[model samples]
Target: MTLQLLNRATALWRAFIVLALLAGTSIEAVTQDNRPLLVAARKKRTQTKKSRATPPKKKEKAPEKAPEKPLEEKAVDLTELDQHGTNTSESYNRLHATQPSSTPNFRTYFDLAFSYRPGDQPVSFENFHSAFLLEYTPMAGLTFMVGLAPPTVLPLYYELDWQITDRLSLRLGRIWIPFDQINPHNTFGGFINTSLLRAASQEAFLPDVWADLGAAAKYDIIRDNDLQVESHVYVVNGFGQGGTDPKGESSSYPDFSLPVARQDNNDDKSIGLRVHGLYRNTVGLGLSFFTGGYNNQGTTNARITMLGADFQAYIAALTFRAGYAYMAVDLPLGTSRQFYTRGGLYTELTLRATDKWKLGILGGVQQNDNNVSDQNDRTIWGGKIEYLINHMMIVSLQYFKDLRQAPGKTNFDVALLRYSLTL
Candidate 1:
């Protein structure tokens, strides 16, 4: 019985050892399978903590800006005005700073002159040649200009100028007739238009600042730094009878009253030619001729002819100018007189006292009709003092005394205070 009990105990011990070994193998297999999953969980936890520690970036704001101001236009250069205070084509183009190009450019300007005449009938204020000018350049060598006076639809002057070549030019429209030095070239020559002898004498025969509807050809015979010579030829509608006859009849006789006739009263047209030369900008000479029929009957040959010559000399601050004009009228069929003739002469001298002061004196004489010695002949003397207020403004005081008919007669006289301005 003791031997059987001992064998049973040994069998129980073997069973216990087999069970312990099986348990150890199962734990090792399970650890190998779950190793990758445990490592991935630890990395995810680290990334979450880093994201929480950092902050987002902020945006920046921009600063405010200031408002801009408007730009102003440039004014004309006043130092370029000639001795006559005139704005010639050369001076105008230079002061305006224009160039010839295919591109278009447009500009506008204003000029005015007004005077207080204390010697008129009941002393009055007068508005002279105030103008609003428009200039246009559409292409190289071409330009168009128009001048207007407000409230009057009529254009004061208008023209198209074409520069065909360096020395040749052509012009059309109602342009200033190239009849004399002052007529075609003078624009805004200070406040004293009456200060020049040419202005006083030419008004009796030719229109002051005479301009007419016409086409002109101008050629520069010689142009250089020290001298310039030019010639002009043109044809235009001549003068007409001053007024319609009282009986509403058209007379075949000539009209001595030469009125500006833009529209032709007759078929005949006027022709004019002028040649001018300037030396060193100090001395100038001009010669002009004009002829046309003034009778209402185009078939008749009643005509008027005029010849003019002018001289200018500038020495230091002093300037001298003189002019002579002669006119002849041819009578129509069956007239008592064969021809009527008239002539006039004038002289002017100007001294520049200072950069801002100028003094001038002028004298002129006119014979209405030399054929018939009547009291219509007249003489004139004038003096002017000009003060330049600035580059764009001028003030002038002038006096004119008329010596008419007889030497001892008390003739009319005028005193004017004028202002000239440009804008």
Candidate 2:
């Protein structure tokens, strides 16, 4: 019984061993089948981990890309940009805000002259004359002036000039009658002509005074080219030939035969007209006509006419001027009538010896129709030397010779010293 029990145990043990072997084989097969799945699962888990890591790397790259861009492309704030733009605008406005100044509108000027002349004769005294002129100009188109001549000769005169347009003007006030080549104030200052002293033929008939107070209307026909035409119509006190009346009244009687005396028939007035023209600022021509009558015991009528021409020319630093005048007069048969015709020719030359010194020569001849009885044709020659201390002061020495004869008189010579000042 022991042997049989042992055998059964051996068998049971073998069977158990076999079953263990089979189980081992099945487990191996199963492991082999699952191997690929395990490897795939591990690969999948690795891919998922790699995807998460790459996402984080991508986020880092996005930040780095921003830094790599150009500095000029950086974003800015609109508010700061607007402030900068406003500041630039304000600066531009300030630079353009200031204004410029305006120009002056009016101007005034004055001229004054004073002269002292010493005569050559024993009976002569130093004569002093002075004039003052003031001018105001509000604009170029309008001007006003007041001039004064102190002492006995010329009275004060006022002038108004209004340029209505560029080409036309209206002038009014007392004006000097324009006739002779030499103005009253400019004719050797206070000296009279030799013809007057010798009583030339023309002097017997011609009027003596150089100026008269009158109103005139002048028109400028041509203005631009230094050529112009002017006409004047006026009425003045009757001609004072030989002497002036005590009351400064003009004569009314036109007596032609009366030599030393002028009778006044104060009932009549005289009218005169003149026309003048200038050419190239060098030449001038004028013509005049006058008519009047003296109402004495019998009414006496008279008529006078004049023609004149003047010339001025410049050669280098020297200037030359000359003029001629002619007059004719008619009087009633019974009334004292003197033939009236007078004229003169004059010339002057100025030489600049130095910057402050000047020398001049002057000569003139005069003829009279009435003074022929006294052989009154006269010739005048003079020379002057001037020294200039400045623009406003001058000293002049002049010598003059008169070639004319009166009754028992011979030619005369005069030396004059003149000092002048201008302000």
Candidate 3:
């Protein structure tokens, strides 16, 4: 019985050992089977974490593509609009607004005067001077002008201006050169209030036929509201101010009444240089110098030098002008040195009595050297009354007095009725 009991115990112990071994093997197999799956899951999780960390790079790339499409579309639309002529009106209006207004195509200015002098010719029309100015501007900075006057008394002057820049310009053709205050264009105007005509000194030395055919370049040193300076140079037939005159006239005629003076037939060519300055439009000053020579009959030559200065100022409605000039002539005859000098002062006061009626008082004095003894020093006074019919027309009456007179010689006195029109 003891041996059988021991055998049973041994068998039971062996069975228990075998079962434990089988359980161990199964656990080991299951562990091995799940090992690769666990490793694959962990790798997938790590790759997903790396992809999530790099999200900002994808987000950064997304914005770069959005602006390119809108910019290209806008460029195409602008190009189409430009090609279809939609941009014309604004440019056209801008160009049109910069143009000047059109006035009457045919424009003219004329002055008619009737003068009566004591113990002189009858009260006939002394001068019927008319200037017809035609102007055409093809572009903004270019202008063409043609002027006509009659009777062969004055030359027909023409002008063309091309403004290359705002402050620089070129002017060509025959222009009325400005050297002194009493010039050809301003001397014979019916609107001048002075009663005594231009001074005899100016008539003899500073004649009215002072024009030149040349080109001019103008530059503005100061173009502001306060100051201005302009320089001009000209090359012209320096026929001394009286234009060209025929040679050899008899000396039996009165010297003062002769058409050609002693120094008239001097030279054929000369150069002129002038500078003008203005301050506030109220003050004007000028300096001019001219040098040339004239050849007379035979080898006699007369060299001429002329220097002049002028000033003009307007203080309110009163205008004042003064001028002085020194002229020396070196004749081939002798060393006597013929000298001609003149000084003049003139003033005018304008009284606005009413909207259409105006009154002015004019007075001036002139002193001349080398004039006739009787006419060397003279005083002039005049008065005028004008009616403004409209913007384009004016009518005036004037009276003048000559204060200096000889005991027997008649001092000049005159009355004038004048009418002027402008278009």
Candidate 4:
């Protein structure tokens, strides 16, 4: 009975194993039939778990940048006014300290001077006055200028300038005569006192201020970095013979008070020329010539001729200037006019003692005429000390001694205190 029970139990166990194997095979077949769906479901669950585990990696921000600064302009080399006084607009503005203006393309300047001379004779305000100048530029290469001096009847200068080319210019109206260095810089107290040549010529021979109504042309023959050559040519109404005018002016015989006349006194006109050269701003030279008929009568043929030469040099802190002038006038002798000649020369030296101080000395000699035996000849010795208060203001003390050649004539001495201001 025990053996029969064991065999039945073993058979039943075998049947159970076979049945489990068959069940496993059927489930695997069912999974294979839905393989795509099961695979997708497994992937989705894996991705969800991964997203929850990692917090989406906080986005990394770019590094902060610093603020930028403004760009700086490069340095530039500036050139000064050339020999023709042709300055660029920017340079002109810098040189003049140009002020703001409401009017378009206009500029104005004021110059004032005061002088006190302790002497027998002082200069008349009419002869030397302050100035106010105005300039108008309507277009490129064209300009108009007017300058007025107080206590004077007429304008000091009024002109129109046209720059035809880079090196050529034309000017018309009452203009400063382009003769010597002094006329170009004629403001009282602005420069050292007038040289002997200028004073003698202006008082006895040439027109005051060397000014006249004229048309002028300036040509820059050569201009470069450090060298310049310029030429000026002009035609003007010649000086009038004294006592012949309706204005009640008397004749100064043996001397010429050649005043600049508004109208021509004679049919003939005057002609003048000047040539100048500069080297490295250290050396300068000039030559001038003028010729004109002074006789108001159309029949009388009397004329005047002038020749001039000037030089300037700079060395260390010293500046030197020298000028020479020769003048000849024709005088009526019986029937034919005779030519009498006069000549003069001056030399000046200035020392820049300090930024605000300057010391200067000048010496000059003049011959009135060769016919006279040392009668009217003269010598001048002068010294000056100046203090510059600012770029546009100055004060100076000047002393001058005059030695005359005439017998028994006393040597004259004078001292001056001068002040100048520009606006």
Measured by lDDT, the strongest candidate is 1
lDDT of 4 by residue, 182-224 (tens): 4333212122333322332223434434557888888999899
Give the lDDT of residue 78 in candidate 2: 15
Residues 297-389, candidate 3: write the lDDT tens digits: 344555556676767676775555555455554434433334344444455556656656777776666544333434434566878887877
In order of listing, the candidates' clash counts read: 0, 20, 1, 0
lDDT of 2 at 35: 100
TM-score of 1: 0.67
lDDT of 1: 0.62
RMSD of each: 16.7, 26.8, 19.3, 13.1
Stretches off by above 4 angstroms in model 3 are 1-106, 138-140, 153-155, 181-205, 240-268, 294-300, 334-345, 352-355, 366-371, 374-378, 406-411
Over 4 Å off, model 2: 1-120, 123-125, 136-144, 153-156, 184-211, 225-238, 241-298, 335-340, 352-355, 367-371, 375-377, 408-411
TM-score of each: 0.67, 0.54, 0.60, 0.65
Candidate 2 lDDT tens digits, 1-423: 999999999999999999999999999999998999989999999999998887555334444444464333222211111011110111111112222322122211122223222232252334333555555555655555554544424434444555576545444544444443333222321224422232223232232223333444445566668777766565644453342222223353233222212434444555666666667766555565555543343444555455655555555566565555565655344424444455555666677676577787777766544433244455778887877766556667767676765543343566666566555
Model 2 deviation from the true structure expressed as Cα RMSD, one decimal place: 26.8
TM-score rank order: 1, 4, 3, 2
Record all residue pairs in model 3 with backbone atoms less than 3 Å apart, i.e. clashing. 266-294
Model 2 poorest 10 in a row by lDDT: 81-90
lDDT by residue for model 1 (116-137), tens: 3332334556655455666667
